[model samples]
Target: EAEVAQSPRYKITEKSQAVAFWCDPISGHATLYWYRQILGQGPELLVQFQDESVVDDSQLPKDRFSAERLKGVDSTLKIQPAELGDSAMYLCASSLVNRGDAFFGQGTRLTVV
Candidate 1:
């Protein structure tokens, strides 16, 4: 079975530090998404990429967060000057096409102190 790959499954950062997470989607999948989930809440879409282009990022905090898929395969998400409220699970998901069923990776849990 295929799966999405994410690194640094756990992270701890100071209140004003920088952090990053990575994800590699399953082969041939063209739609990738970054989601943030607070412990008791449903995951919120942070960004979405179709191929190498960003198709949606309306909820992404532009001033502190960024995501990219330079080659349309693997992607990276970064947070600059991370804040305490930013602690959450960062999830990466992918589907073979837009609106298709997605497969998710074990999320990166971020803890800010």
Candidate 2:
């Protein structure tokens, strides 16, 4: 199926290093979102972008996590000085607007030690 793309389905990293992941949304979609899902928890919105502009990033940890959708097509997320508590499932989703169900990628699982 034509779908979203993500890299490094799993990652292992030291607690103080940096890591990055990438995502590509389906064609013709205009809204993109980044979410963090801890084990046994619902997905939490980290950031949202409308086209090339950031719409919401209230939950994102600016000191450790950052994300961007520059061209508004694909996006990248980075975590610097990773913490053990940062270990979780980083998911990427895309939708036509902010109100509907979004198509989700398999996610990148980060494990910090």
Candidate 3:
């Protein structure tokens, strides 16, 4: 059986404010990730975690954007003092260890005003 992920479908916020998006990954999956996509561009990896430990977050803007996989089951991504350029779709994906076919959530589309 297949399981669908979870996240708010959309979000609108003013610039210089804070916003948060959540994702509940498939049960038993050990890997979780957060991605950002600008209009007309492919998704870019923001952060990845393996069982509550960060694997990679070099692309993430540590000053404003933060991601975490709490208890290695659910994840959250937050942006503080969001900028206009930060408006984009935030996607959360999960996969088995070193396996193929990662599943993604509905994605949170953020529009900064």
Among these predictions, the greatest TM-score belongs to 1
TM-score of each: 0.97, 0.96, 0.95
- Candidate 1 lDDT over 2-104, as tens digits, reads 9999988999999889999999999999999999999999999999999999999999999999999999999999999899999999999999884679999
Predicted candidate 3 versus true structure: per-residue lDDT over 11-100, tens digit per residue: 999999999999888898899889999989999999999989999999999999888877888988999989999999998889999997
Clashes of each: 0, 0, 0
Would you list the rank order by lDDT, best first?
1, 2, 3
Give the lowest summed-lDDT range of ten residues in model 1: 94-103
Q: Each candidate's root-mean-square deviation in Å?
A: 0.8, 1.0, 1.1
lDDT of 2 at 65: 90
True-vs-predicted CA distance for residue 69, candidate 2, Å: 1.0
Better of 1 and 2 by TM-score: 1
For model 2, residues 31-85, the per-residue Cα lDDT tens digits are: 9889999999999999998888999999999999989888999999999999999
| Pairwise TM-score winner, candidates 2 and 3 | 2
Error of 2 at 22 (Å): 0.5
Candidate 3 lands at a TM-score of 0.95
